[model samples]
Target chain A: MNTHIRVAPGDLFGDGVFETIHLRPDGPWLLHEHLARLVRSAAILGLPEPDLSELPAFTGEDIAVPGVDPGSDVPRALRIIYTGGRVHTAVTPIPPAVLRERRDGVRVITADLGVSVRRRPPWSISSAKSLSYAENFAARRWAVRQGADDMIWFATEGYALEAPTASVVWLAGGELCTVPPAEAGILPGITAAHLLSLAPSVGLRAAERMVTLDELVAADAIWLASSLRGLAEVTELDGKPRPHSPWTPRLLTLLGFPATS
Target chain B: MNTHIRVAPGDLFGDGVFETIHLRPDGPWLLHEHLARLVRSAAILGLPEPDLSELPAFTGEDIAVPGVDPGSDVPRALRIIYTGGRVHTAVTPIPPAVLRERRDGVRVITADLGVSVRRRPPWSISSAKSLSYAENFAARRWAVRQGADDMIWFATEGYALEAPTASVVWLAGGELCTVPPAEAGILPGITAAHLLSLAPSVGLRAAERMVTLDELVAADAIWLASSLRGLAEVTELDGKPRPHSPWTPRLLTLLGFPATS
Candidate 1:
């Protein structure tokens, strides 16, 4: 959907926060949670919390059209961007490559992020998903240069932190686990948290733990979970091949995400 | 100064390098050196060297306009922004506050940047003035919150690094000095380098040294030098008041900049 807003040149500085929500036929998935995180992210950046109560309305009629094929499923992505002056929303089609990665999985590598876990700045917003994503883009680019699809960043203390755009989730001994965000000083992953909340119904125990690279590699299965990509299985890690896990498809279906090719 | 360009949404990610130059009546001050550093900064960030030849041609006719006061005696600020897709340039009038800081100087604070000096990332782009400036803006905002005009960052190893948007230069026992960019892992300040190069003619010694916070505070004079704000002296550091230095005016004159408010 086309949307427009006027902004000053200074607004392009990337000192803001954003959230991307999966839009489904049922409605925008987990939108309230996304909005809550957006406010939390803004608070970390010292920005006033955005008011969603008066947000411009986007009706179903605006997104659904008469000529659209009913048989073909319509998948939409909603992005809410809040800077100093403006709060904007836009909708776009899910990228083909993102769908491809979900189907075939991704080749991932691990790298030392070289940031001190104990020495985060007084204004450190690492735990908040702010819009200053150049470093994130750079990390991913570095991984691509290393012949991988994405990267997992570790703290200087040798603890697996998180991916540039996803949360590290693994299964070990029937327990589904992800990093403890506060202890690890990472952005809290809503998708991973939601999945963990549902783990008991799936006959699995859930946990948040500080994991080392060795311990992560030894896990039964590993996945990088995020909102848009849903869950991308780690098919390979650091040039080493990993055996395919049957749980990948099962987890995707459990999350109400389409199994795409 | 109202120039516009067509850019895709992805271009706003701040994945680029930029430079701001002082545009004098003679032309853009130190144009060649700025361009060379732009290329060097791009190299550090692994970005292709921007083609300087493709820069929007700036002619006297372009800036000279009817009804505009040519006798205002206001200096211009030239900004060059280079992303993966495009290199753009724009000119604007320098703000009065920046000019006042250059004249009357600034109150400064020093803080630990919490970055390890020895453990620079393998793909570290610290020496590049990249566009990932959210942290830099955050640093300045921090200083403002702390009741100071700006801040000087110190590495975890205790050596004083540069400020968020400017280079740290100090006078000590007749020697002019700054932190060596390569060794300290900081973006080399072109203005600081140019001032040091001209120091010998004024019978002053010039050198690069790794200095601690104490040594910086004890220096004869300290200044945050940049293109837009020529030299803002540190009247106070970390809330401790400092005696006004005689060298502040001398250095400003030596750099062909205004020495007083």
Candidate 2:
């Protein structure tokens, strides 16, 4: 499953878009939402509209794995990539760090991304799920080196934008809130958006708002939400440790994930 | 040759670095300088130091073409790519647009990159010549779509930076200058830096300083410098047609480029 795929040499220059979806025995989670975002990302990059007809076949190959071994909890991640030269799709096991952060929490840091949200250009790709993710990876690496698990980026004006690989979600004043993706010029978080939509079912109001770093630090709880990690709670921020949030397990349940151990 | 090369599927994710060098019948122009930048870029991305013993052999294969045909002026480009899994080297003909711009000059525009240089984060990779170049390509595509050949990015503080794929060079008061790459947080341009190093021989002083957009527009002459396109004069800027400067040909010649036709 960890096999390499062929691509035109030029296609590897990061002039493309991609999407990662959580795969399960039943089907890919939020399949349509992920597909819609993939098309949106492609348009942002001016790449030709991708042909997604082959994706269903690729995802269906191991949909019945759980039936053979009900107790096995294997994690599979499906990636669909669209480049100037071609489209590539693959499924691989989710990495161990992702599962650990989801079950156990993550320590986080804050850093200025050096970008000004109010001065965005017409060609800005920050909102697109672009394949130019080296900066994001490097930011995370820097956080790891600083003895943290992830780093949340902020605009120059002191508002939290998003984490390198996930959307920032928090609880404040009895409401579930996440950063407004459009205003922040970041990728719209599929998991965070869906969770917000379901917040009322759990007796909480949902919101998309700009939260300052101070406000975020003062919030009841914080988590980084993405496709693979669902929500990795911010266990420690800056240098201060926070007690685990009781809502972590309840929200995981609402999202149809097994309760955090 | 325009042939495809196989790569690991993960390699196409743009978590790598690359250098594009101008290939000549005699040798790759600025081979050592390009390699030195390659190492710097790799270190910025945390990739292992690359092995370069094979580059000389790769460049030597077709170095004797002039003896077989004296009138050949085919432009070749050599690419060296180092990814998480492998190193790839290839030689291909230079794109016609590159040659055209070098010969006929270019029309350009300036836009805010939305980055605040004064608040750069510790992990910012803006200086790395990374494979994560979707933003650069997108920026150029945007300029081209707006009826210009390329765009020069400026910082939020109004100082001119570099073009998406090239360095901004200008002449002012008998001195040649480019934006200080380290201070500007940009890829150190091999062509621009080398041209400046050779400025004394051409009776011009070399300097690296921060220049505002107004100052750049008021310069005696302006050009975009890169490996393949040695110097493309700024023929038009912000929709205002600039008269071709006689120095365009002289500077090109100073940079070891043939006189513009």
Model 2 chain A, poorest ten-residue lDDT window?
Answer: A62-71
Q: Model 1: which residue pairs collide?
A: none
For each candidate, report its DockQ versus the true two-chain complex.
0.47, 0.77
Chain A TM-score for predicted structure 1: 0.94
Best by DockQ: 2
Deviation in Å, model 2, residue A173 alpha carbon: 2.1
**Interface C-alpha RMSD after superposing true interface residues, each candidate, one decimal:** 2.6, 1.1
Clashing pairs in 2: none
- Provide the clashing-pair count of each candidate structure: 0, 0
Error at A90, model 2, angstroms: 0.8
Fnat, model by model in order, equals 0.36, 0.86
Model 2, position A197, has a per-residue lDDT of 97
Candidate closest to the true structure, highest TM-score? 2
